[model samples]
Target: MGQKSLVSTWHYLVALAAFLLSYFAGLPMPWIIVGVIAVGLLRYAILSKTSKIDAIPGPLVIVLAYVGFMAGFNHFHQSYSMAAIGLITTAYFTFLPNFALIFVGAPLIERTQKNTCIQFILSLVTASVVGVIVNLACYLGIGILFPSGVSSWYAIEPMALVWVLFSLFLLFKYKIGMLKLILLSLAYGFLLFLWRLNKMPMG
Candidate 1:
């Protein structure tokens, strides 16, 4: 099998592991979904005509970032087990999709002569939107099943904001289509309004 096929197969296994672990441990389904999505995107990129999957840097950077963030969070919040788990899970799953983007889809995308930069920016925006929607659904489902009394909106609002900021950065850097940018911006603004209304002061 080709390197792309090998990588795609490995990603599938990793996603399966994530799903099983999350399901049995009741850790969180969103992370598993993210893992699956990452693997799926990686496979798609590898099989696509453009062959952009070769452009992304290795997973080293993302791994390092995850480790560093986890270290810092643990250092600051050692006593908070739930908070630590949430942070670690979020950080780990956040970069799984990037693995596909950078390793499988990015290189080919970068080399394209037809507005590659714009395409990259648009892809980020699209990914952010998808991530937000999926995560929101996951959070709501978890709340319904557990009834742990956690606020679903509060749980997801921060991550959604982070994705919005990321999308905004891409939009600004690459000068994506005006209409899409405006829509993303408006969506972000609406999310922010909701967050502010629900936010309790961190005393």
Candidate 2:
């Protein structure tokens, strides 16, 4: 219908404007949400007679994928020596919104499921983000336990290797939560600490 297409166009325009504003701003990205509210109160709610700003989360997911990819690339490619806790923090900021939306904004997406293009984009973003999280987790875990750097074939020790396997298992089997990921990372760090203490030539 003409009316449905018009509504979709409006959503895209608002999403694009907010996305660009946030990217160019010096402050954090959530300031984009504030800008959307201001515009909604003035132009959308009054001048344009648009009753509400329907947030099309497709754009948000796209941003998350980019941030996750950049974070993973930077953390790994820098000699792969970043702290596990540091990388976990980055994952939090990247995934938190998607986590929240799984309950709140998900229903809205289902309700307005007419746009096949949006649905296709959303599916790709979801799959890409999952891959990013898994890959980043593996790198951070390995880097934490192997500060000297891993081989091209990755000849990690047995105990540290188990932690790596467990991380992947949690990711694939149990829908790994944020707390579990952080705790597992800490466990890896602690185990590495014990290994160093044992390697001090036994006094």
Candidate 3:
């Protein structure tokens, strides 16, 4: 591991660059997407004769840990108790599926590493899956912290239950087009917000 680490020193540099670019771009959770694209470009398009992107040692994890910290603070720090962060983060077991998807996607990526455009496509998919994972964690964390309000919808509404089940099936069983799924979630979140606003009695 140590020997391999020395040769892959450029990995974190690319990661840092990705984070800065994400910050400037104002994209939510941009680090993973940027890092993935950078590594792909380096391996397939830029340095194809010299190196491969797989050497980057999964830079997504750096973004993952950063997101976790923010999740810890946003979800837990402002809650009834700070200690709930540990329990909520732990109880959700949200990272399990994300890590599982990463492992599952690893072997599949070998088939497309040689193509420049295809590599970025794969990177986008990877970032999308990570986004879903992190979103799931935060979602479950909210429920854990506020059970009555956050988790009760599924029980009262059959459509909600069906949608939740279908979403899980799509995310875990199916492996392609994750970016679409992320967009779907974003749209759903917006509609949910609007629905809540509509419920408010205005003066």
Candidate 4:
């Protein structure tokens, strides 16, 4: 299969996994609906003919950024308005391969274009600046509503730590060609769903 096709397949599989596992997890229906819409939008953004980067799909970027963002919020009490979260997420995914490629490297994308390496650097800088600006604006306008407290996902579910680390490992190692990332993430998501389901009261 072609590179774009492969990337799309990966995203489709993962998105489906996330949707189903999230439903089984007993997440609020609204949250699952929004998540599906977000994935659909990311899929459209990355797959559109006008997309700049070929190898790195938008949903991968979203997942990496989201994991990092939630990790911070859950651990450090780093609270921000939903607007700021949306802006940050939008900026990272819109720019394509922002932080994910920074940590993972872009061997596949680099092979596709003559100047993408430079473009990658510039895009990273731009995304960072935009993220900071929007975050500041949100803080100044609405203020960061600090929560009373929040449990870290890893603490609440120790397996989450393993799941995240393993996901990042495969992503960094470029094992995605084997669909290891999708499969492993789906496995982890399913396990997470079961964990959450078990915690819910018997109806």
For all predicted structures, in order, the TM-scores are 0.22, 0.35, 0.29, 0.27
lDDT of 4 by residue, 86-192 (tens): 33643444244334443455565465456867678856756664664454333322211212213443233345445556666777786565466656666777787
Worst 10 residues of 4 by lDDT: 140-149
Model 3 worst lDDT window (10 residues): 48-57
Q: What overall lDDT goes with each candidate model?
A: 0.46, 0.46, 0.45, 0.42
> What digit string (tens of lDDT, one per residue) describes model 3 on residues 1-203?
34244224324433443343321222223443343333342332222211222222224444434333332334343443433442343223334544555567667657667989987785786676577546545544343334356555453444345556667888889863767776776687579769989999999
Among these predictions, the greatest TM-score belongs to 2
Model 1: per-residue Cα lDDT at residue 27: 24
Model 4 ranges with Cα > 4 A deviation: 1-156, 177-179
For model 2, where is the 10-residue window of minimal lDDT?
47-56
lDDT of 4: 0.42
Q: Tens-digit lDDT track for model 2 on 31-99?
A: 323333332323322111111122212245443333333333343453223333334433454455435
lDDT-better candidate, 3 vs 4: 3
List the candidates ranked by TM-score, beginning with the highest: 2, 3, 4, 1
Please report how far candidate 1 places residue 47 from its true position, in Å: 39
